[model samples]
Target: MPSDKFDVLVIGAGLAGLRCARVLAAAGRDVQVWEAADEVGGRIRTRAIDGFLCDRGFQVLNPAYPELKRAIDISDLRLQPFGAGVAVRRQSGSAVWVHPLREPARVPSMLAHGGVRPAGVLALLRWSLPALRPRALKSSQRQDRSLREGLDRQGVRGELRRVIDQFLAGVVLDDTGATSNAFALLLARVFLLGVPALPSDGMRSLPRQLAAPLGDRIVLQRSALHVESDADGWQVHSPDGVVHATHVVVATDPAAAAALTDVATPPAHGVVTDWWATDQMPPGPAMLWIDSRTDKPGPVINTAVISAAAPTYAPRGHHLIAATALLAPTATPPPEDATRQHAADILGADGRSWTLLTRDVIPEALPAQLPPLRVRQSVRLAAGLWCCGDHRDTASIQGALVSGRRTGEAILRSPARI
Candidate 1:
């Protein structure tokens, strides 16, 4: 027996769940969202302490996110674009500015020096060409190959692989060898289209805004323990009570989604850590720095300065530095002191100079860095059940939003539901 019923029941009040609820609610559907946590936003999290606004992980809003623009009011959030370009610092103690494509005339001359290499210039040309720019392909087709394979086939190597791999790791939070080349290229295309921005307040505001209009319709601290479907419709069991609805959406991470229903396969979970300081550090464009010289087991990618992305993130004169390392399921959490020491070593700072503000280890920060959509299925075994997450597309914020929107639209159009 169900405690309550609605036209649509959504699980996981993150960006995807909230977006689906917002769209269905607007269409006059009786919708309700269940969230395991006390608040919404899922991975897009923010925290304030001692006058510092720190995010769980370093996040940037892509100006070209199609569903984000349509689903949320970006103007209300007042996003601030990055200053100009990203400064890539190499292991050999050399650095270069990768200027945004919008200002091609400003390509830094220093990039042509022996220490600096132009790897993606040719691929950029191909993607920019009128004929090669537009092509239609299914996400599944794009996921059948790894990034390394695709790059080798396309003759992208040496210095180009370094640059692309660094950028891909930063965006997807995984190594290029572990990710899909087509998906990485699609991300690069997004940057070429427009600059990445951050909200005036913080990234968390995006999901909060999406969940706002739903009001009391959203249930918090209620994790959906299980979901079972039959001929009639779907039944979702939460800590609170069971809810019967015409359709069920599991928008949580792959692990949680798998636990709720037997239909989803659990994807790999990665870890990300953020450290905040209230003292001014280096001044430069927001960039991803990879220290190839480090002796760490896995590739350690760090972002030196993000204050430029959103100045309000830190106090007037402070800096926000973030570093992420993908961890295996059997790996143990690195000691806080070790993490701080690693940060200091990478940034060339004395470990004691910076105070650790906030640290979060989202064990499932990202799905396994596989080729795109290889493990994702549009339709699950359950008749009226659907799953949505970054794993379903390109492993990105945009992918999550787009997948959520498409799933919701698909459910609404299903004749079986009518």
Candidate 2:
């Protein structure tokens, strides 16, 4: 069979692949993206189930991400912002803490919860404020430590520490608090500056928006099996046929990239998210509910009334609630019964009547964002081979886009292009 050819070929159609293709194509480089999935948006996909929009997993879009702003029209997404507060479930009940800057009127209500200590507040500020300035977070100036150690060193203990740890465990999918302190602080900076929101349709709209400009340059269901260096540049072997390209970008997930190239396998963090629909109007603002009990009640790290944040997610008269539990890559997903019970306990609601919409078991939800943070890993694999993805960056939508943009810039500057 004849081989198809292009100036550049990008594997995987996730955020990274799409962004890289955009940059290269914009530069007048003949580019084509081969995505393995039937549709685009790898992990950032959504499905309509019984009139409910269920994402591959629970995810939110932050408008503050620079790459996000550059990649799509935020206004077109019709963003639905979450309340800048969280409800912490305790032994007694729940306590809500809203950022005073965003919700000053809620200060009295927050103080009513009674866990905010002056010392903890000051320590938290001391630990996190520096992240606002990129120069302050230079890894060389300070040794990167685990979040637990950083919080302890900064004297962020007791209830404040518990709330932060539990809430972030859901965000990073690591309950051990072993995530890099620098990386965590950067994430905090992002939240501090902007509220996370969902698109009117769902998170899938993001990749779809990014892919719009590329037109038919993207060929779905074309999974690249083996990529080998050839005289012209590289040959990507797919079940359909062989495609030759002057440059190849392995923008797949960490595991797939490792399988296809010489890149080392990085540690992975997994998550199990269960979506349940209920006739009960979930009481409370559009905020995340975190289990902060000293003697934890369930496996769920966090629970939220997603419909409260994105009303379009559920059909009229029904609310959509999501509970997420951190699972090891090899561990069995928690049973639906346990997940439902844990969500109930955290939200202090009766979920007995709620219907389980979907349970997503993602063994590779994210590449572990460990300590000694290297924000920009090398994308070039060899003379003409390259790689880019969340695994190559900070393990977020922002990181993925940034890595892809960087890869495109690097390729444009390379002298090896055919």
Candidate 3:
């Protein structure tokens, strides 16, 4: 082994890239990271404009991800907790209501809400009880029922169906019809037991924390053009210079990884988020608000007054509402006027006081997670070459970090990385 060669060269400064580098570095391996973007955190980026910290998209971390303890500490994130259960806006009543799983005392009130039928309550309970059990994991993956289909089969109708679809769309960034049944079980589990949270500073703080230890080992604005191997080992070509490494980790997006590794590129889902600032915060426990109507302008998937979740996200006396919707491939986002007007009505906030701050349209917000949701994805792509990312693993932060760690572990054991 040449002293000048890097033990591992990680491409992409996203969550997976940083995590892979950190693990390799900890094992006394000489590692370097390359990123095409000027800044780190990839899609987890946060921007500060006029004293407001706007996340690239709406994201939340659930406590169920055990990987959090492995990569970073919760205190560094200063997590802001979002209350359990969603606030449903009954399409029939033109009013907002709650399921009260958190407030069990309100169960009777929820039952008598006139819109919620008795059969709906039974169906919801039948689905929820299994999520708490271990069997839900297998059942969800094996069954062909998506969240919407499961609800319908259980005899859930009218307002309950609307409420369920509206809320689930926020998590999956798509309608119930498009979501897989495997995810439905996971959704039930999260709804029942998970505690949703966010970093007080911004979501990007997470990737920053992971990369902080590497210091100068990471190079920015240099994308991984191509990776090849010779008798001398691996050569990772970049715009500025080439990195000579014993092993190479391709931690880029789906399409890039597919191009680099000759692996199939899966379809990606697009999510467009528009932010608005207002003096009055929508009253609640940071619950998600969904649009039950498709005819509504922008056809918003979900809206949340994020300032309620993280106060540092906004300036004094102001709140931020993020109106989100699924975008078609290459389609433009709806105008700000329509998004704001629709959001104001959904959250019951005054439209006059709302001000548009910024709109971030992420073409690849998440990988399309359909049927056969595996608990883990393989990280090794070829001999001495590895790949890891949300596309190669789960579509959430947990999947990205976990896959990166898995790649690091495999690299550590390989004699090639020595």
Candidate 4:
């Protein structure tokens, strides 16, 4: 390969970059992907610590994502599934609220135990059923509202509302319910359609699967410092050397992408995830637990026995648990003591003996899915330059793949100036 020339140069090796390059390369385009990290997967990476597989943050792969289905074969992931619904932790005890379609048997028990209310169920249906329709799912077609206002208008209240709010806080990394209601409904539709799960290795498996075919096309430890357009095409400056290409795709994270392209920086949602190892596993099926105490919610938004969901995440006899807290912009992460105590309270376990594996504080975990959600944001910045990532779409694995594929398709359809 030439040291500083290519048909196309991609600036990041995340899902978006890899998927974009894959599409272009498959079409016989000379594409080379440059990733600053030593490995691929970007934010979705997994770390091996003392025989434990720890993902950078709490993440799962939803087979229901349309783009994901088209990009990679799901069977290869060896997915370990989580239960249909969450375990709501109250002062007295915890109750599991599952979807009737996924786990009908649990519905009866849930009702008999006063875990669910008919009004809340009806309200939830009213708010979420429209998401199933093609037209309503399109953000551009409907009247948009903040999640908090939308829930209020739809009558999703009381304990059910609390559970939904808390659970979604972890999902979107925002506890304030300021995210777009339409986006939340779309997210709910996917969860209803498919159970999110972890691969045998970790969330990193998703990116690794996408990167496998590209092989040598991906250049690791290579970061593009600046990008400039020339008469021929574009030039990407890096610490290593300058690379000139007929076209360039800035597929890095939102912050990095903003720096290298004309794209405006989007607001980011932060999250703090703590992984704990314990000899005694929490007794429960593989499901998320959210605090629903009538008094007051704790610092932790959600906690789960990760090992129960994917045993491969832990060593032979030990178990892995994860507790996640939403971080406000410029706010320090909740103290370790608070999160640990909240985890214990929510799980009804004594985590005093548990070992703290690691704490991951990602201030830019995901782009904020704010109100008036804009789906399919433009990828074509100029004739020969493009950008693609979750920020350009729905802020998810699905969005990243879709945006990348969109850029690749758009580029393929246009005539090359060079």
Q: Give the number of the best model, judged by TM-score.
A: 4
After superposition, candidate 2 runs with Cα above 4 Å error: 1-3, 416-418
TM-score against truth, every candidate: 0.87, 0.97, 0.91, 0.97
Model 1: pairs clashing at backbone N, Cα or C within 3 Å: 147-181
Candidate with the greatest lDDT versus the true structure: 4
User: Can you write out model 2's per-residue Cα lDDT over 19-82, one digit (the tens) per residue?
Assistant: 9999998998888998988888878999999999999888998898878888779999999988
Regarding TM-score, does 1 or 2 come out ahead? 2
**Model 1 C-alpha lDDT per residue in residues 110-178, reported as the tens digit of each score:** 556523445556654543332233233234454347766766665665654566666667677666376
lDDT against the true structure, per candidate, is 0.68, 0.87, 0.77, 0.88
Q: Which lDDT value does model 2 have at 381?
A: 90
In model 3, the Cα lDDT at residue 276 comes to 82
* Better structure of 1 and 3 per TM-score: 3
User: Tens-digit lDDT track for model 3 on 272-334?
Assistant: 888888888776557777655535545677788888877888998988888887777788877
Model 4 lDDT per residue over 63-124, tens place: 88888889998899999988888888866877888867888977888877846788788998
All-Cα superposition RMSD per candidate = 3.4, 1.7, 2.5, 1.3
Q: Lowest lDDT 10-mer window, candidate 2?
A: 133-142
